[model samples]
Target: MRQNPERRTALTDAAIEVLAEQGARGLTFRAVDQRAGVPTGTASNYFPNRDALLTQAGRRVFERLDPGPEAVGEALALPRTRASVDRLMHEMVDRITAFPSGHLAMLELRLESTRRPELRAVLTEQIRANLQENIDFHLASGLPGDAETVVHLYLALSWLIVERLTLPDLFDADRTADLITTLVARLIP
Candidate 1:
């Protein structure tokens, strides 16, 4: 197998785009190679099989979606109040929505996972770890929320993102922002 880190990352990123645009059925090595503009067989060299490619794409989506340290620091700088939590929630929605293709690829992986046990395990583990990380951050930041509140927000915001991406006509920006603020205010003590 090739050990070119840059090429591997490119291939996985291309796979993400392919997954988002074409769904699981279109995630072939050739498709990834074409999307990456690499030679045919390039993706196959990096990923042994379709499952490997899908799993890696899932990991890559999270890697692209995870906020940087600067964003985290900024969030931590806010006052520990319900209003601050509301702002944080809005920021999160902005961050997630900023990467539309990454989130769409995530939704694709989720649907694909329902049929593939191995893929299911990988996604479940990654999502759980991300959830726990959010819970830990909320607690350590002295935010106005418990673990349950975080969980509720996670669920609500995740679907809200889906609605925004899949059906933009359903909710405009102001309405979405209002929903997030209301969610945070009601969920946080």
Candidate 2:
């Protein structure tokens, strides 16, 4: 099929929506096509196989969810104080929790990775790169944590936010920001 960025983007988004709503099992070309409101073979024409679609869908989720370099630069430009860390933490949590659908799509990516080694390798590499970027951001911002501590704490906080935002039954939403604030206070100070 001819390469069309807009069409490909729509298809990838459709894949994420299907994956988020129905999980890996139901993430088929037909499902994406149906979700995208496109022709039956449209998704397959864009993505030759399941792995390609899954990989692109995973990438799309992160691309949509991550705060990116500009935001990181702005955060790092803030004064190197505990308050900066708190602000950054709040911003990160807010970005992740602001959209439950994005987190849901990411969860689908992680689960799909568990079932597919090919997908796992791709996800693992991307995850490592993202963590490194986050660590680099925090270190540059003078957050009082090494890469290991920063990443671990961030992951814990993120998991809490995701759980609270998407699966409120699993975790209390009322305490999430407080939990994040406390974690940031301890980790940064």
Candidate 3:
């Protein structure tokens, strides 16, 4: 039996939302069906298992950040003024901080991939894609040498963003800007 492509996509999206809200630990076929307003068998027919559902959700997460470098590059190519860079950095921080579930799912996948060879490859590809996007920005800015370092800085800051939200103190947007700016400055050619 065939499923509607549009509905399958919708189900995957609903699964991501549920995973984000409950973490991987709480994801269930029933919950996804409820979220999608489809029958449980509908989700089971496509996913068949937790891994399949999660893997598809991971791909969709990356899809949402499409044309990654070009998108980030347009923002970077703006006037090289202080205010412009500041605005860019603030926007980047907001966008990254807004998707807690995506971040959480990535973290879980990273850990799980340690024992699952197939998952490790998928995660590796994601890392490469992310690195390439960062490298693109660095290259455009004439800072190719610092590409890997900048990527590391971003990973660290992202972890901090996640952990900070868990604490009583909310994320300080200003501090995040200062950190990224200082890092990017060091990466400048």
Which structure among the candidates has the greatest TM-score?
1
**Better model by TM-score: candidate 2 vs candidate 3:** 2
The alpha-carbon lDDT assigned to residue 138 of candidate 1 equals 94
Cα lDDT of all candidates, in order?
0.93, 0.81, 0.69
- C-alpha displacement of 96 in model 2, angstroms? 1.4
lDDT, candidate 2, at 174:
51
Better by TM-score, candidate 2 or 1: 1
The best-first sequence of candidates by lDDT reads: 1, 2, 3
- Name the TM-score of candidate 1: 0.98
List TM-scores for all candidates, in order: 0.98, 0.91, 0.77
Best-first order by TM-score: 1, 2, 3
- In candidate 3, how many Å is residue 178 off? 3.4
Q: Mind giving the per-residue lDDT tens digits that candidate 2 earns over 63-115?
A: 88878779867976888887777777778777877766667877888887888
Q: Pick the lDDT winner.
A: 1
lDDT, candidate 3, at 151: 68
User: Which residue pairs in candidate 3 have backbone atoms (N, alpha carbon, C) closer than 3 angstroms, thus clashing?
Assistant: none
Candidate 2 global CA lDDT score: 0.81
Q: Which ten residues in a row have the lowest lDDT in candidate 1?
A: 180-189
Off by over 4 Å in 1: none
What are the RMSDs of all candidates, in order? 0.7, 1.7, 3.2
